[model samples]
Target: MGVRMRLTTVETVHEEGSWLFTVRDQYGADEEVVLVPCEDGVEAWINRCTHESQRLDTGRGAAMRDGQIICPKHGSMFDSCTGYCDNGEAAETTLPSVDVTVEDGTVYLTDDEVSYLRDGGIDEDEDEDGGPSSTSHLSF
Candidate 1:
């Protein structure tokens, strides 16, 4: 099992419909994950689409319909609970799912690397030390 990290409270998660959270994997790489409220509890998956690696939400809340997550770019539908894409160009593919749970009113992302700044955007500006420092403000 990977590290477990508290993301947000259940109430907050439902209030926002869905929450996008990022984590740093063991290799020090960032991964974007989104948490969606479901009937059983909460479902979490990577924010990218399976077809062309586009963002599923593009900074907006995930578009859901008939218990499926809709890809804005390709109009593909993925089962929210299972991440399986049974239609559209992404057939035979699945959105990467991250394990999560709502415990004591708090949502926790588990069995994965937890880093909050993975999706903070890249910094093309170099610092005084000749290394990239964030030139733009971080967004989502």
Candidate 2:
């Protein structure tokens, strides 16, 4: 068990399809995590797709269908509950897990490798100027 930091309410995650948050890893690098509703509770995964660096949820929310997280890049589907991809480009890969727990309707960040920073992706103001945006490679 690690430091339990409050994230957001479980109901909020369900309403948003997914919740995005930022955390700082032990190495001092910032990472994004997404929370999606599951059968038992909410599951958190590193925001990027397993096949590439594309973010699964680009701030607004992740595209979810039939309980799976849909990759916006190549349409790969990952199980929201398990983060496992059985088909498409991401097959055989699992989204990096970020340990989280839900208790009394509120979510908490419990991963020892990361410390909660803030909600949503890294702020643009905090990013290096002139650096490419995360979605710059997308055709749309």
Candidate 3:
């Protein structure tokens, strides 16, 4: 089954060079989605690191090390400029991105990708491509 997702809101960050906006997914309710700014645009992924969903809870947004947000949970480093790989640890696990488009100066995340963005989690054991399961912490 395809993952379900939705565009929730927009968040902005102030950097030395630019003011960036992150298109947040509806997946995370009390949790924050990580935003890595890039030259092409912005790379938005679920803040939860694939290795463990702990750093996201600890408020380590992008896991920055030496001004870079490397997930503290796994030391995974992504390009703050393109959301790609700085060290490339879990190549199979993509910093999952939702389909986002801008219209009228507003960003919108497609509905098809919203479910995964929710605070809910999936059984990683069953689906290799699926995200961390939040069933134990089910909030719905």
lDDT of 3 at 9: 29
Mark the 10 consecutive residues where model 3 has the least summed lDDT. 13-22
Per TM-score, the best of the predicted structures is 2
Instruction: Output candidate 2 Cα RMSD.
Output: 4.1
lDDT: which candidate is best?
2
Off by over 4 Å in 2: 123-140
lDDT of 3 at 65: 43
**Model 1 lDDT, full chain set:** 0.69
**Residue-level error in angstroms, candidate 1, position 53:** 0.3
Candidate 2 has which clashing residue pairs, if any? Answer: none
Model 2 global lDDT (CA atoms, 0 to 1): 0.85
User: Candidate 1 or 3, higher lDDT?
Assistant: 1
Model 1 lDDT, residue 137, Cα:
33
List TM-scores for all candidates, in order.
Answer: 0.75, 0.86, 0.46
lDDT of 2 by residue, 1-140 (tens): 88999999989888888999999999999999999999758999998888887778876688898899988768788999999999888899999999988899999999999999998887534435512344323332
Give the TM-score comparing model 1 with the true structure, all chains together.
Answer: 0.75
C-alpha lDDT of all candidate models, in order: 0.69, 0.85, 0.41
Worst 10 residues of 1 by lDDT: 131-140
Q: Give every collision pair in model 1.
A: 23-115, 24-115
Error of 1 at 96 (Å): 1.1
